[model samples]
Target: MSAVIDIEELRSQFLDQEFDSQEFVLKTENILTVARASGETRAEFSDESHPDFQAPPALLCSLASGRHLPIDFPAMGGIPMDGGKAVTRHAPVRPNQTLIGKTHLHDIYDKKGRSGRMILIVARMEVYDTDDNHLATADSRMVIREKPTS
Candidate 1:
């Protein structure tokens, strides 16, 4: 597991500070393979279908990188762990379309637990199409546990 982080310190650093938004432009090719495997049929994602059949919901959910979580969290460490769930807004993605994703830190909360202190980090991500149309929005939550050390 990673060294226990000072939650207070981290909080202070982010308090009232605006996190720089990260924007990513993804091409259709970047997501097609996984989209297809996720049951997104070619007909629904073909150039011919453009502006018509929307991208499957599952495909968009699968695109998340999950890199927002801390590297040292126990569950994410060498030991097995369960990550938090992501709530997605219903939307469709189109084929041959370029999508842009914008990510920002939403909120962070601390709680007292049996192990010690636990921190919950929430991030909001929005995906848009070339025309700036909203495709989907996801609120991803990550839980990190802190254990006391002698």
Candidate 2:
């Protein structure tokens, strides 16, 4: 019996799979580096002791999983695209503090496109402090586009 496999089933294989936690200390140099690039000069982020010196929110992207998010979609003659992402900040991440992050497969859904079906994979990343306090949660969605018919 040959039956087409659904993308949800493929994703289930990785739903229980988890990645190693990544831990790193947020250095002031990095904060300033991003500040210079993002033009975020509120003194709190650039200065170490400005009474509200906190690491830039976007800096949390560095703590994201370096490896690809666990998603094994069915065969598709197409390439994956950025598709954009949505990040949510919990507690403020401070400078010079070690932060630990863990990522896992969160959700997967599909939609019909003009060319073909488009599958969207959403992976969640959670970051915490050395003390085990949750700091932030980031969910990134990537879309796999089917190759348009000639």
Candidate 3:
């Protein structure tokens, strides 16, 4: 059993409020290491000396904020599960670039699942370079649902 979540209340209190922020200095060695580990075969991502050498898109996943949600999460009282993440790239991320990531509660909503009701929370993190150029946006989803009784 779980307490009912107040979607409207959560939205008003948390939406767009920054919860976590982090800074990362992209290094060629680290980027290449991640690329190779992820089995990326692209020369641009694996070869630092290549003219188009760039950080693999998957590298942004590692740059996510330390915390995904606000410290004071809503009192939904349900089993929370990771709903994965979606990343949208606006510009290429290059090595030696200093990037900042700021995360916030983007949205909260409910759905009627097969077993019961489920609440979905979305945390959006916007990434920018030292020059303030938008680089990417990562939306992490979390799902809350009631526990089944034996």
Candidate 4:
């Protein structure tokens, strides 16, 4: 196992600070391609020619900033792995529009698991349009655990 980690200290140092930002242009063709590859049959998601064509709900899951997590995360001395991701959409992502994704460290915590103690770090990305309209938020969870030794 790792040394004692100060969760509150890390949270205070990282949380609320913007670590990375990226801009994504939602193109019609790209949206259609992603939709089709994901086996989407909805006209609005898969058909660009549709009057109400828009990106699928899961599209934001693929949009990420340059850095997944803050580079200076506290060393928990464990094997880090991708826990999972969650996305929430507030508005339709239409084609030919630019969306800005700003990423920050949202939270940190530790819990005991079947094998040992594990630390979970949550990174949040807030998506907004040029008009400063909140469009979506994606939270990426990373798990840190010690290597199992027989």
Candidate 5:
């Protein structure tokens, strides 16, 4: 197995890094239709009077926060492909709602691999409403494989 990764060190690289969190302000005109067969109800994603309603869950996770790029993978000695779990919050998102997403390194660990070593990078993604209230949080995991060069 490879050496464990230092999440603190990785997070420091993103410290003071500011990103525009305003891109989530989606216009009603931008709303897309969800197939009826998808079982999305009007009360769940849209209103009967207006077909152009936004889903809060979708808006919360709309964009990849800038912090995603800087995460370090100990096995690769650099950033790995962005991977995360899909999380949904119970709160309803309304149109013209603004959201901010922040990402931080959560943990890192290693496991033995058949060929060499495998490393896992875990990150926490938090989304907040305009009021700074936490809307949802997700634990994203990235896996890196370290194979010896022949």
Candidate 6:
């Protein structure tokens, strides 16, 4: 199998490049929903006007951060897989506040496995607040598997 795009070119075009930051407002309803679904009894996650209303830890990176992808993936005609994500929280994420974050292509490469040629693209995102205080970083990896030819 052959790569759909030049691997090196993809890296040069995306890696370490910062994109425009996007704002994600932590709605009260969403926070409450997640807290209830997670079987959490803490009022911080559901109480919008509470002074301690904080976002659920697991929801920090759940704001569709991929919407800020720095680069667009070409049609590779391959199956895509969510390789998972790693997040390092630097501060508490709260609700009823606008959060700003941007995503960048952190790394990209290709590999050959028993299934076929696989391409891995990793994206890194930094979340912050209106004051520009860093809150967390999440790295999400996506894998593309080459399509089988008849």
Report lDDT per candidate. Answer: 0.58, 0.72, 0.82, 0.82, 0.55, 0.77
Worst window of 10 by summed lDDT in candidate 6: 64-73
- TM-score, every prediction: 0.57, 0.79, 0.85, 0.86, 0.59, 0.79
- Model 2 TM: 0.79
Which is the winner by lDDT between candidate 1 and candidate 2? 2
- lDDT comparison, 3 vs 5, better candidate: 3
Please write out the lDDT profile of model 1 over residues 1-150, one tens digit for every residue.
356656666655554343333445445664566556666566655444355545555556544544554333224233213345464655676655667766655676777877686777666667777678887876666666654554
- How does residue 136 of candidate 4 score in lDDT? 89
Clash pairs, candidate 6, are: none
Worst 10 residues of 3 by lDDT: 57-66
Q: Write the per-residue lDDT of candidate 5 for residues 33-147, one digit (tens) a residue.
A: 4324345566546553464445545444544434443534233554465555556574555557786667665666667767666656665666678788876765566766654
Candidate 3, superposed: residue stretches over 4 Å from native: 147-150
**Residue 44 of candidate 2: its Cα lDDT?**
85
**Top-scoring candidate (TM-score):** 4
| Candidate 2, superposed: residue stretches over 4 Å from native | 1-5, 71-78, 147-150
Clashes of each: 2, 0, 0, 0, 0, 0
The residue pairs in collision within model 5 are: none
Decide which is better by lDDT, 4 or 6. Answer: 4
